[model samples]
Target chain A: MMVACAVLPAAARSAAGPTNPFLRLPMVTIATHRLVLRPFRRSDAKEFTRLAGDWSVASMTSDIPHPLSEGQARGWLKPGRREVRFAIELEGRLIGGAGYYQRRSGTAELGFWLGREWWGRGYATEATRAVVHYGIEVKRLPGFTSSHFVDNNASAGVLRKLGFEPTGRGRIICTARGYEVEAVTYWLPARYAVQAQPVMARAASAGRWRAWLSRLAGRPA
Target chain B: MIDAIRTDRLVLRPVHPDDAEAIRAQIADWDVMRWLSQPPWPYTLQDAVDFIGSCSPDDLTTTAFAITHAGAVIGVIDMRINPALLPLRGPGPHLGFWLGRAHWGNGYTTEAARGLLASAFAAGVGDTVYSGAFADNAASLRVQEKLGFVRNTETLVFARPRGREFPHVNTKLVKSAFRTA
Candidate 1:
């Protein structure tokens, strides 16, 4: 499942070339106090398919399709894709995904989805804060813009807790529902992002070392 | 392909590269821009070129024309799909336009937009069209009113260039209503 933040910077965006620094940044792992938000690996496909295939999860997102299969999940997680996607891990298990997508120059949108079992656990909030924080602190983005289907108050609550203010109303086509849905738009400037608590400052580490260090550092198994 | 549609005093046709200069010149005026949602303040030539470059004559998503008078490019008019943002019964395109500051009061905007709407319907874009203007943009509202656009709702909408929200009037025009009214 996906939620998006799209903000095009006037000076940096051009028809021919994008000067936005975030557009050039590679997707990397970000960590929060309760979650490990890392870019998806091919092996995570099975778990991704399992969680994202649920209709309730798929309907809330803009792009996730219903009845998603492992093969489809793998294709979407392919390396070298423009948008950055993360596998949200808890207790070393892939429970959900979150990431930032640069739809055009100067602006990037944030999206995330957790397995139905993980609902109401605040995992989405943690993972989204990690990604949004990374984009602002590391990628130098000014802020993020997000939208939620009006009926999806749970998602709205996550944004509200993250300091995103409702700006207006818009619509986006939900691929799962096969129709456009009314959505409320929200914006969070980088300054507000600083106020989001528990933004754990974890460095990017790769491979077995990351898992070993995560375990050694007294985090969840 | 976007073909030229003629009115009594203006020719509406697909915007061209050469129109970039005129677009930049006309839209740079604060008086011309304060109401527009996208184009940044201090509009530039590259912005005009980019806009013109993105227009596809064969693409149904947008139909943009350089509003010309006696062969001189003065402004632009376009009808673009709302992409299902409103509560309309079926698909409907949004009407957007801007006339060069020098050309504002001659009824040219209404004339050009009317011709473009006709062309859009002929091309099967949509039967109904939706439009919006900043509540303070009385001239824009008057233009819509002149074309029989029925005021539907007023809502707060973000104008990106201005970086703030403003009350905006959402209006709709149906072919049948236009034909009778």
Candidate 2:
């Protein structure tokens, strides 16, 4: 229910002690060669309206409504408790959005949605990696957690690529489509916060070269 | 009520005022704090004082300890009631911990965690305990899974600071399963 942005500034902390007990970190921009994970711009509203308006993108996400309007996109761009929601952009056009939300206690959760056009591309992984890194290294958050509709294999794949493991599953009534769908839960620890050299090493050595080559070839080569 | 938990290479004891400096040092490291529920950046002596002062065993509902290795406090662990909700009559406590960056990757947390689970069971607190890791946090989840905590559910956490909802994976450990694993 709490919507958080990815680029919240640290200045938002109340000077009145730790009464709130919520820790918010600044937004981080993760850039790959072609994509720029940065704050959403007002100009992006039109593009976001078009992309998120698609039923394909809207169906998988929790809050997004199909036929997303310009006003809706503008509202979505507003900052939340954590940071500004980042417009996942490729070549300066908005493609998706991702950010962290501090829910309760010291825990925070990761969320993002990409347009259907960007599916199969690695932008989600790239942006997610950036946010995860910022959440751990910059915000100094404890961990990042997430879940997706069981049928959303693309989202699940993105989670796996970012090192999130399946933790559990449940059923949720989808408001958008008015149906109950199975939700798959996944989680990831701060790689730097905890010692996970072996896991990291395994992931790194697990045909990373091939993966990287495949990604390169898929690019505008 | 006072006891020392010993693992293969570490000791966890009741946190005392003397451990404030070490606690501050551990929290000051961004790496240690980043994965913690509390922001460890800008940790100061006052935070340590307040944290240690807040560790009241008399409450029984919430207990914390300083992790010691070779006579120095290097980390911390605590089991507390789920702050978001009242403790279910038979549900076990929620566990959380943070070790200094330098001491990580050496199996210290796992060792200490095992000891804590044992202590909790010995105290007859609850039939099962629950814990969680953020979706992007792989290490904490790995530790929980390694210690035999089963996945329970995924939650959309609303971080107030960022003002957004995030996905989280929750895990629980039942006593019977703990003993068996």
Candidate 3:
């Protein structure tokens, strides 16, 4: 399925300014020698809905309810108080989501889920690392935390490789699975003191323009 | 005698009986108590004492520590573990914390959270950490997010009191996505 593939216009990618209160640092578009991380677009709604709405994705996540709908996917893309929410772009396609919510506390939580077709390709790990870097270097956050179902070894393995140490667990009601599952917690201390290059400046600039146009057009960014 | 956990900028120790007045004053403020789940209204010194006395190392399930900045206790950070649960039965620990209103916007909670998280990780306590806040509690939620806690889910009916309702934004932090900067 081609899904939504509308490219945001160039004019819409450069109209951002300092007065743009919503404009953050930049959407860190990380390229880890393999994948590209970019911001979400309105066109991505169809595919995002299809992938995020899938029972498989829902089954693994505690928050994503089953019978996923386009409205929910669109709602997920809407800007909230959090600063970083980006689409996991691989080979120029929106495959998943990876970003930080609760941007100010010097620690932002990272969450991401790939479509079933995109599974086993290491996209989740790549996207996760990119976001972690953004949180530490670009955002200058001090720490970060994440968790997964105990049975979701893949998620756990990704966190471990990123240097997160497990510290606790809790019980969560997985609505899609229709049962409670055991979740393991992990944490990573903020050690990015050296300040890396501004990775997301371009994406931020482009995203701001798009957001402005979306507002102008009365469409969501 | 209160055991103190000292960091470069702050000291985390135990809450004492005499500290009750300060605790009461802190929690009684609407800015602080508004986001808290317990202690409805009319917060008193007795409430502070009860809170302190309830915290014991032997409890194993919950560990509450008083946060002190410049020699004065300013807030509290705690870890809640479910002994009856699995995964946690092995190597994971859940965490939660709060700072007094006077201490807001100063990175105190973040400092205290990192210190406690380090202690928990260093001890080989668990493999992951989880925490949450009310959806509207932006500051508390921001602290957890800054620490890399992802949104897990939202609970509709977390707790209800006399003619009042409380919902929670349940968030979790897995080990795989953690990075130290």
RMSD for each of the candidates:
18.8, 18.1, 19.1
lDDT of 2 by residue, B1-181 (tens): 5677788788888888888888887778756655554442367898898888878755334658889999999899887775332211115578788888888788777778888988888888778888876566778888888788876754333222222233455678888777423
Candidate 2 lDDT over A69-109, as tens digits, reads 78987887776764436667666567788886664433456
Q: Please state the CAPRI-style docking class of candidate 1.
A: incorrect
The C-alpha stretches of model 3 lying farther than 4 A from their native spots are A1-221, B1-3, B58-61, B82-92, B157-163, B179-181
Residue A120 shift from truth in candidate 1, angstroms = 19
Better candidate number, 2 or 3, judged by lDDT: 2
lDDT of 1 by residue, B106-137 (tens): 99999988887776677777668888787678
- Candidate 3 per-residue lDDT, tens place, B132-165, comes to 6765688888888877788764432112111122
Poorest stretch of ten by lDDT in candidate 1 chain A: A199-208
Interface RMSD of 2: 16.3
Weakest 10 consecutive residues of candidate 3 chain B by summed lDDT: B156-165
User: Once all C-alphas are superposed, what RMSD does model 2 give against the true structure?
Assistant: 18.1
Q: Report the C-alpha lDDT of model 3 over A1-221, residue by residue, as the tens digit.
A: 01111111122122112432221323334444345555677788899888888876777676666787888877767645454666766656677877655433345566678788888867676667667765553444556777677777777777776777888987766767777778887777653211221332234334444554465599987
Q: Which docking band does candidate 3 fall into? A: incorrect
